[model samples]
Target: MMIFEKVKSAIDMKTVAEGYGLHIDRGGMTLCPFHNEKTPSAKIYGDNFHCFGCGEHHDVIGFTQKLFQLNKPIDFVKKLNTDSGLNIDIEKTPTKTDISEYQKRVNEQKTYREYEKNAWQILCDYLWLMREWKKRIPASPDDDLDGRFVYALHHFDYAE
Candidate 1:
């Protein structure tokens, strides 16, 4: 079994949350920590938790990671092993291939972000030009330029 499966089998999310001092009711409900709520909106299941108030959902490992701000999954696993006295073996060092793949994914995300930024800028500029044209163009019922401009503006407004 993988490390994730081992951790999941070893840890109960409800117990972990209780260890953090969050009061969980017998019905498996608690006040959501991620958001402000008068009533219990976070529900804990056998393997995971979901908050209806903030929509925060995660397994046991993810719960600990978010709660303690651990940087990586391995870090969380190590912490869990230490705290729970589990003998799950995990590699302490990542391979070169792993580092390369991580860097590639990071680069791809950066490129996608740049593309989205440029696309939004272009859309905003086009919307501005359409507004300026609407101001300069005279109101003519026969010509549908005004109507088309209005439609374009509405489309871009929602798209942005």
Candidate 2:
């Protein structure tokens, strides 16, 4: 149960291999650093990882030893846990990257709100201009200035 919790705490799988100076590719897979490898044969799963080339399959502890060439798995695990600052929260929230994405969405929403506000202001200005123009123009018998102003205001209210 302790190992399980430790493994769970070590969420970043790349941290193990990176500690050993091994580079993981963008796909979260890396070439077998245990031996010379022409192509990447390591497969990183959500809970565990395995290297097809060297047949190295273990939990976080096993991974640290093989990757770091250490004699003791426990020492490797402890060192890695401490070095990487493993967060062992039972009820962990999403990472800062997720929060940054949410912030980006909020900024986009604010941009849209500003656009909507500008559009509403333009529409109100256009209505005011039309009312002034109507007053200056000679009114025909059929022209109803009161009715037009009421209709435009009603439309603006509905937009809000």
Candidate 3:
């Protein structure tokens, strides 16, 4: 079944109204949220509501859409799926462009993560090597300093 049909069949208008913080009396009547009113003019039915004061009639989906001021009906469908735990599958088949764009973004993120990982590994190796070279001190003060030790002394701070 389509998402809208399934949702309408699975949910009641009164349940939806109450879920969104509207108070319903024993008669399933509540003050209309669409307009200011002191008396309860809207009557909630099984899958629809009718407002006597403003003449506003809407089904479950329409009521949710209007209640949230959402631009698209599908937005309310998603919200209903989450809030009501309907577990309805609402995804449409992706087009070629959509698949390609998704793959492109995934590839870009993967490439960036790999580069970051490799850079961090290289920096850690260089730092460890510099520390080892620092241990290679000359045997005597007059002895010639090892080139690697000299390089380690100069570049240890930069490597760190």
Candidate 4:
């Protein structure tokens, strides 16, 4: 979906841009981010915003991606369209580049998710085994008696 379409359909363009640190003032105009400016020459016209200071104007999706230096404009568009109540028509057909990149991302994300799931399962199984072993074998005097075993396990597993 085009950013223009998304922005034009949404009502809270200025609020959304402000949430991204654009600092809209004087009816959604702010200092241009593309160039150094003391005065606010930027203007937001309904869904689209423009900066006369640097002559940069685009829809909210473009503004968001440029402001945050996102890698993909599509990613930002998808996010904004999904989160900010901007409805978009689904593409009837996908292009080759879109299909290929989406497939690659699906494969990578699947592998990563599977790895995480397996790792979590392994830890859970290990904890069950440990609990069983502990039931079978009484705690020793030298064993650290603090109930921090689960906390330590969680910290080690998820503290990325």
Top candidate, metric lDDT = 3
Mind giving the per-residue lDDT tens digits that candidate 4 earns over 16-76? 5654567666666787777898888988776677877778877777777777677776777
Candidate 1 lDDT score relative to the true structure: 0.71
Name the TM-score of candidate 3. Answer: 0.55
Give candidate 4 misplaced runs (Cα > 4 Å). 1-8, 81-160
Candidate 1 least-lDDT 10 residues: 85-94
Over 1-160, each residue of candidate 2 has an lDDT whose tens digit, in order, gives 3644544443446545554566677787887766788889987765567888878787666676666677865666666555544533324454656445534544564467569869989988876765554454336757755755555555644543
List TM-scores for all candidates, in order: 0.51, 0.45, 0.55, 0.43
Question: Per-residue lDDT of 28-137 in model 1, one digit per residue for the tens?
Answer: 99988878899999999977889988999988898888878899888987786566444445653445554455345445644675698699899889777766654644
Provide the overall lDDT of each model, using Cα atoms, as 2-decimal numbers. Answer: 0.71, 0.61, 0.80, 0.61
Of 2 and 4, which scores higher on TM-score?
2
Question: Residue 71's C-alpha lDDT in candidate 4?
Answer: 76
Model with the higher TM-score, candidate 1 or 3:
3
How does model 2 score by TM-score?
A: 0.45
Candidate 4 local accuracy as lDDT? 0.61
- The better-scoring model by lDDT among 1 and 4 is 1
Cα-lDDT of candidate 2: 0.61
Displacement of the residue 110 alpha carbon in candidate 1, Å = 46
The segments of candidate 1 whose C-alpha lies over 4 angstroms from its true place after superposition are 87-160
